[model samples]
Target: MARSVRWVTGAKTQWTIHGEQLVDENRHIRLSTADVELPDGTRFTQYVARMPRCAMTLVFNDQQQVLLMYRHRFIIDQWVWELPGGYVDGVEDIAAAAAREVEEETGWRPRSMEHLATFQPAIGSVDQPQQVYLARGADRTDTAPDVNEAEKLDWFTLPEAATMIERGEIVGAATVVAVYRALTLAP
Candidate 1:
């Protein structure tokens, strides 16, 4: 069976605002008009952002557990268990950012890592696309954490993590998604 594809219409930048110090908002498709002619002549206009993000799932083999951080989110006003990750700096590769974040948050380094998945939590409003990576054979060398970002660090087994998810102990969107994926991919 042949599948049909849609084409984009002409679009223009309407306005932009600073979402954060590093990220910005762009209302580019607001002025879109003149539908583009596709091979099948079907057209569509979609608002999108080109934002970038980085995330990691840290798995420690010796303890047979995953490294998680219990951090207080100011926006939510609660501490939640989550995997360590953050936004990638300018021109920083995703793998480097993942390793840096894991070390920054948990004071541990992974011996190896591999790309897992990419997701966009909110396509309608937020333009951030989170890059998820899996870190294997991690080793703990220190207890220091990025004090400004997280509070306590802990390790959880797969079953314990499932329980935490069910009990709502793990709340961050990216963390939850990544953890779930890791559990499924676990050997």
Candidate 2:
């Protein structure tokens, strides 16, 4: 049985933290385990990921094709497609981070940027908020993908990208979400 604890938010007492402990942590991710009780006194344990927020971009060229990166994610032991993005540095602006990622990963700098959406990719366990930006025009930069970053960069039409997702070739969460948003938000 779960016990009640004073919660201090919105005068709503739906959640109570019974106990929590840090399981592991590093520069990139912090994992914690928490025992929580719900309004109905239901208790459960959850492992949470405390990671820095990420910034990603959905950039389209003059042909209305989206840019993407191909990289081999060791975790899945397979190659996957992803967007130009990374964690927001501690002292850098989020939008600036997005632009920096685009330049570093794809050698392109946005002429104008617009916010498409901010989303929590895995709210159930991770609180990593991703800011997706829609970039209208970009110019080539001298920079290139950092060593061990992207294997290659390419562009695909909106429908082709969606088809890639349907084929399980585009498996990145940020890529999938940003592509969906671009298709709906722009088209």
Candidate 3:
């Protein structure tokens, strides 16, 4: 049996700059608007922002506990528990980025890492795709927290993680999704 796939076309009609921000007083992002046409004879406009892809990791220590970060997101105005991760640098490989992120955020280095999965949190609007990796047999090292990103770091058992999710403590989409997947596939 064969399944048919539908393809849609969009044409850019107009683009305008809305605003810009200096992320670090040097790097900046310019938000813009664009009018597009749909293949189904529909016309619409969308606001888009250029961003970079990010890499994250689900790291398990010798005790089988997963590393989690307690961080505050200004945009969301709340603190949540999340996996350690960050944007991919142009000069860095994906696996390297993942390992770097884990080390920087959690102070743990994995003896072995395996690719787990990749997902777009919001494909319709956001351009960022998050790649997740599974790191096993991690050893705790000295940690230097990136104060701008995370406030606390800790390890949680699977049951504790589930409770956090149920109680709305761990709310990041990628963190929650990755944790559940890792728990299911854990040996």
Off by over 4 Å in 2: 1-13
> What does candidate 1's lDDT look like per residue over 1-187, in tens digits?
9999965569543333222232344332122222233444455543344555756665556767888888888898877888888878877888889888888877888778898778888775556778778877787767677888678888888789878988988887777787778778847
What is the Cα-based lDDT of residue 2 in candidate 1? Answer: 100
Candidate 2 local lDDT, 1-187, one digit each (tens):
9999976777766588888899999989999999999988899998989899999998988888888889999988888887899999998998889988899888889887888889998898998999999898789988866767888888999899999999988998889999988888635
Residue pair clashes in candidate 3:
none
Cα lDDT of candidate 2 equals 0.88
Leading candidate by TM-score: 2
Give one digit per residue, the lDDT tens place, for model 3 in 20-60. 34323212233555565655457666765556778889888
- Evaluate model 3: give its TM-score: 0.80
Ranking by TM-score: 2, 3, 1
Q: Estimate every model's Cα lDDT from 0 to 1.
A: 0.73, 0.88, 0.79
Please name the candidate that would achieve the greatest lDDT relative to the true structure.
2
Clashes of 1: 0
